[model samples]
Target: MIYRNKTEAYWEPLLTIARDELGIHSFDPMGKPSADIRMCRVEDIGRALERAYDLGLMVGHTVTRAGCVNGECA
Candidate 1:
């Protein structure tokens, strides 16, 4: 149950911790990014960690493409 609001922080860190600490597997892409987090489910911690890490890296790439270099998306 991942409810998102346009007034919060990214959930990637927390979700990653959940996988490592609680062994709860979940990830999804059902939110307005930069203001929302996704959720999904898996059966194992390893899988969850893998998927979440992959997603994190992917998102990083997305940010890099249109990233601000000199205070603008240069």
Candidate 2:
């Protein structure tokens, strides 16, 4: 189940709960929120990918300060 912590951004607080509480692995801090929430699951890698999509994470490309890599951003 998803939950919250001290963070106030879109998905920032969940990171701490996922790692410190649920013990799930977190992604690298790219496309990081202003805060630090992260999502977790017992076995839901697809769900995590969906969450990233929901949060406007463009996919299938390398992202950088310039823009989406090769017209994609995942």
Candidate 3:
């Protein structure tokens, strides 16, 4: 599925949390697993989740916004 927000403003912060906070990096599927795809420990997931919550990205049980910036909410 296509992402609603493809801008760097939307993705950069999320990527920072994923790469800097969590051990898992390199979303590239074709890259080497050893260096590119690091396995995430349980603690890593917890830390990322906490960071996401603090950033107001994920609240309660919802995530997707009500409307899209391009007026293509569906």
Candidate with the greatest lDDT versus the true structure = 3
- Candidates by lDDT, descending order: 3, 1, 2
**lDDT of residue 43 for candidate 3:** 89
TM-score of 1: 0.38
True-structure RMSD for candidate 1: 11.1
Error of 3 at 2 (Å): 7.7
* Candidate 1 lDDT by residue in tens digits, 9-35: 457665667767555455544466743
RMSD values, in order shown = 11.1, 12.5, 7.0
| 1-74 per-residue lDDT for model 2 (tens digits) | 23434355645634644455455555454354643464556456555455556554433232453376455556
Q: What is the C-alpha lDDT of each candidate?
A: 0.59, 0.49, 0.63
Q: Candidate 2 clashing pairs?
A: 12-36, 12-37, 13-37, 14-37, 14-38, 15-37, 15-38, 58-74, 59-74
- If the candidates were sorted by their TM-score against the true structure, best first, what order would they fall in? 3, 1, 2
TM-score of 3: 0.51
Full-model lDDT, candidate 3: 0.63
Looking at model 1, residue 38 earns an lDDT score of 32
Clash pairs (backbone) in predicted model 1:
26-40, 27-39, 27-40, 28-39
User: Which candidate has the highest TM-score of all?
Assistant: 3
- Can you tell me which runs of candidate 1 are displaced by over 4 Å? 1-9, 12-43, 68-74
